[model samples]
Target: MRLSMRARWALMFGGLFLLAGTALLLINYVLVNEIVPQAGLFVSNFAGGPGVSGGATVTAPPPVLDKQFFQKGVEGAVDTFRASAMQKLLIASGIALVVTGVLAALLGWWTAGRALRPLNTITSTAQRLGAESLDRRINLDGPQDELKELADTFDGMLDRLAAAFDGQRRFVANASHELRTPLAVQRTLIEVAMADPTATPELLRLGQHLLHTNERSERLIEGLLVLARSDQGLVSRVPVRLDEIVDAVLRSSAAMATEQGVTLASDLEPRVVMGDSVLLERLVTNLVHNAINYNEDGGSVLIRVGDRPALLVSNTGPEVPASAVPALFEPFRRLNRERTASRDGAGLGLSIVRSVTHAHHGIVYANPNHGGGLWIAVDLPLLERTMTSLSPRPGADPAISRG
Candidate 1:
């Protein structure tokens, strides 16, 4: 049977006690029965010996001492001594075994718990862990034993994970910025070509199409950079109104929604949160844009907000499978597997939304609408204090920073 560590220790101590007690008892028994009273036996034999004469056999007169009685006394003394020693040994062993067994059990339990304390710490650290909180460590203090080595190994793993995430974020940011410069130049050239007065109808159409494609590429690159930055960590926290941010994003997206013949509706209750306003605004914008972009003609979008710093955006559009809803938040994952030359979206909208939500320590969920379209909800921590002064404008340039 595989006993627990504490149980094993207890059994070990108990076995040692039993073995030592048995050995000591046997030694005492042997000495009392075999070695002691040898002098009394010699005296009894000398006194009881028959006398021998030359030629004729002669019997010696009985000694003054009662030989039989004296011998019996000597034998009785030895037997009594042996019996007394055996009784005392048994009593002492019983008492000692009970007392020491209890002490051993207690000590074993305490030692086992103390030894496994670091393991418990490691387990809790692993349980509470997430991608953003990779800096947490067991940093166990004490002798460099096996448990300490295990804790140190776990801390090293976390260090490696943190480094990998940082490297990935850096790569994404650099690539996005590098991609944006050429895209800007391309947009400028295409605009100049579109401005040419003598351009044929086909040339004008081609220039307009190129401009749209370049814009979509720019949006995709920017979304990637934003997603990377959000994953890196939140840099600053300021009071932000969910309603105000949503309203602002709605305003920016108003023209696009109108052009698409999508109706916008909102139930913006006062919901204030503490986070990076730019990222929060971007998050809302992404959700709203996705809702607007993937809707049917004359469809409607409902934006609802609550005091819990919660927001839910539901829209009417094509039927979305429940199984496919989760993959919608992945970067560059579109509903259509066949990548047609559609500039409608670059498919990073929901992905950016999810990243920003995570950076702010929030929960986001998505459900496919009953008939058609998608429903997205986000919940963030609410700020306790109401703002009396005007908040800073959220037009700051996006930048990646170390956590």
Candidate 2:
């Protein structure tokens, strides 16, 4: 049978007391048998003369060792020694067993409690940590022991959970908003066309409007899918030139700029980075498109790329509130001033930019431009090889240029 820790400790200490008590009793028995008889013989030898009479000397020499008296004296001495030794041993054993047993029990309980305290905290915290109560954390204010490490790990898990839940909430809200826009437009167009059946031109216009709305819906869904894939870390990535991506975005944004009467310019320097080229291109394109779409008439858009690789796209537009800047990269957050603009987007542009930048281990922020517009800055680490290729060589395009 197996014994519990406490029981084992008690038995160990009790056995040690028993062994010590037995040894002491045995020592007492031997000492009493040898010493008592020798002392009796010495006393008798000193009391009796060297030539005492036979009867007196022989019969009363020493009562302890006399053959006639030997049995009785030895028996009495042994009995007395046994009684005393047994009594002392019993008392000592009882005291030692009680003291040691209590001490061992207390020690075992204390040690076990100390070892399992963190586990208890973990269990309690886990029980409380569900979908509604993810913010609860374990108390780690103890020594830097294994339990503290365990608490730290638990805190990390809670952090991850909180981030994941926040992401999920944002995603759902954004998807709903994006989906609602096209559905609302389609419904309005259908109602108008039905109300004016006499005008074929209106009907045709409404059909075109519905088609465009459907296309927009499709695009939003596709964007959501891409964002979901990116969140899942499923996108294939490879090394692509950062400058190439900027050039591509600038070319794409030029047509939009011409339509808006806004000039789009870029100063892109050659630099390489590791990422999915297609996504990076799309990310840059979205930023440029957003900047140009929201710019004022006759406004200018600037794009810059170089070491400490950055893309600053600023345009002349109405100022955004300083407090609202932090939420600009959050999905579905639209500026108050732009709420009335017909070109207000689905509000996922900056979110996509942030997500893509995060995937590449980069940061993007928005700040007020000096000329009364917003500046979106994307800063990413430059790859080692990109630094080596920075020097201008003969017959090569200048290291930096604006086009």
Candidate 3:
């Protein structure tokens, strides 16, 4: 039902070519009909009969009567000759036109292919373009035309995009140091004040609260920086054991889980995925942290790694509405929660998870649990080498949930 650009172009060119040929063929036929004499053009038809006119048993040639009869005969014979000649001419011309029209169509197809060659190059380049490879350009070289203008415009847009990302990357790179130092200093000051021997109970309580606030601020800033970095995409990729990363994240997250009165469990399979190890760890860490922090006391967090996708994290918490599940992956949506009442999140955990997963060309899916809480699954691409070498007992669990 739908035609590709190349096919459409070829068809258009062929149709126009056929139309011109048809017009020329008709014009030639018409001209021949108009220029030729309709009567008395052929003298051969009026030649004298052999011997003399005969009758009865022998057939005889037509006998001329007066001048009017002779003129009428000549006109009739000439008309017959003209009609025969024109019919032959029309048949021959029609055959030639058909043959040439086919050739013209073939030529149009080839020409269309050649004309669209640059578009193929642009398409392939765009398909491979990534945040890390934004310096690429079509750089089509030819006479100034629409396609040339299009490529140049795309290149210019990429240039501007590359510059803007570079600026954001610079800010994220420096932010880890510049932004965190002050928060660290504030935390240290608060701790020192609370440790003072002469401090009253009231003062110590105030200092302790200040310290908690400072730590929360630090977390918020750190999450923002990670989110920003991940958005720029991975700078490089290497094979990393996703199971191992989950294990490490759980170990680090155990204390937080205990503090929140939540239990941590895992079912890790030996699965390898391609991505930056650091970013992958951050992705797992965020998933685990969110699982623990959002749940009620005595709730449990379960993490699993298997074939297809590298990771899945699930936890029991307050019942999440099915309609409101999409907001979990959104950054700063947690801000609304904090504004109303204090929570242990800066609202960037799942945002980081989604961002890092996308940077690695992976997907995140999430849904509300039947009982309560959420079921989040991350489907990351596995290397063929790893998949064939040590295939997991099998699962590319559907996009059930994301943090």
Candidate 4:
């Protein structure tokens, strides 16, 4: 049968008291029965000796007197001794049993609480955890002890679970929104083409529209797959120069900027970091694409890389509201003001950039630019080898020195 913690403790302490108290009472009974009677007989014999009684008692008193008196005296003495011993044993045993039982009960209760504290914490934390508070954790102290180790392990599991759930939610939301956009466009074009049967040009336009929608859907699917793989830790990583990556992104984005009538400029410096080159390239590409797509015609975009292994992409555009910046990194969340006629995206660009940056142990943040644009910053730690080689040494290689 399953017993509660308190019940188990009570049973344990009660059993111990029973065993101990029974043993003590038995020892007291043995001593009273044998030793008390023998000692009483010896005392009676000594007191009934010759010349010990008064003249009224006559010579040595009668033998009957001695026998009867000794017998009576011994009987009374033994009775009194037994009574006293029994009284003392009862009092002492009662106190001892009470004290022992109370102490044991208290100690048991305390120990039980200490033992189950981790489980209690786990229960409480689990109860409080939900979609909005997945990052909450149990306050386990250290890993050296057993319960603490278990709590830490549980917290780690929660961390992974929360990440998995969040990723899944983002994937579903982004996929639905991306799919919805192209399908809506295709439906609208089809209706227009059907209604205007005499317009051959309109039919051709609708055909082109379907092709574009298909292409967009395909790209969205590809991006979704890339994000899923990154979340699954499938991306390969290696040391790559951040400067070179920035240069490549700049070159690629420059053509797009020209087509959009936006100017692209870069102020990149030499910096190395360790990460997946393809994912990092995608990260930068998404940021630049977002900047260009959201910018006004003749807008300017600036890219910067620094020794701290930071990348900043700022474009001249309408400023996003402060309240909306936090949601910008979330999938399928677009700022109402930035939803212009020229902008076209599945709204997964920033989400992808944020996820990839997180996988690389980096942070990306978006804020309003000083003038009238949005600024996105990617900050990562420099490569270990690069940092080590940068440390100053006497007569070091001039080529390796910081420019």
Which prediction has the highest TM-score against the true structure?
3
Worst 10 residues of 1 by lDDT: 394-403
List TM-score per model, in order.
0.65, 0.50, 0.78, 0.50
Q: Cα-based RMSD of the predictions, in order?
A: 10.2, 14.8, 6.5, 13.3
lDDT of each: 0.78, 0.68, 0.80, 0.72
> Measured by TM-score, how close is model 3 to the native structure?
0.78
Error of 3 at 62 (Å): 8.4
Better of 1 and 3 by lDDT: 3
Query: Tens-digit lDDT track for model 4 on 253-370?
Result: 7788899899787776666777788888888889888889888899888777775548988888786777779898887677773442223666678888888887777888888876
In terms of lDDT, model 2 sits at: 0.68
In model 1, residue pairs whose N, Cα or C atoms come closer than 3 Å (at least 3 residues apart or on different chains), thus clashing, are none
| Candidate 2 lDDT tens digits, 74-155 | 4466467656766776678667666765676566667666667678888889986654457799977888988899899989
Query: Which residue pairs overlap in candidate 4's backbone?
Result: none
When sorted by lDDT, best at the front, the candidate numbers are 3, 1, 4, 2
lDDT, candidate 1, residue 250? 82
lDDT of 3 by residue, 1-403 (tens): 9997888887887788789988998999898887765564332333333322111121224555675666677678767877898999899988888888778778888988889988988898899899988989999999899889988988899899999989988888888899998888888888888889999999988997787777778778888988888999987888888877787777788899999999887777778888899888989988898888889899988888887557878899888887777887888776237632335567778889899999999999998887888879999876776455765434322223333
User: Model 3, stretches more than 4 Å misplaced?
Assistant: 24-99, 258-261, 391-403
Worst lDDT run of 10 residues, candidate 4, spans 394-403
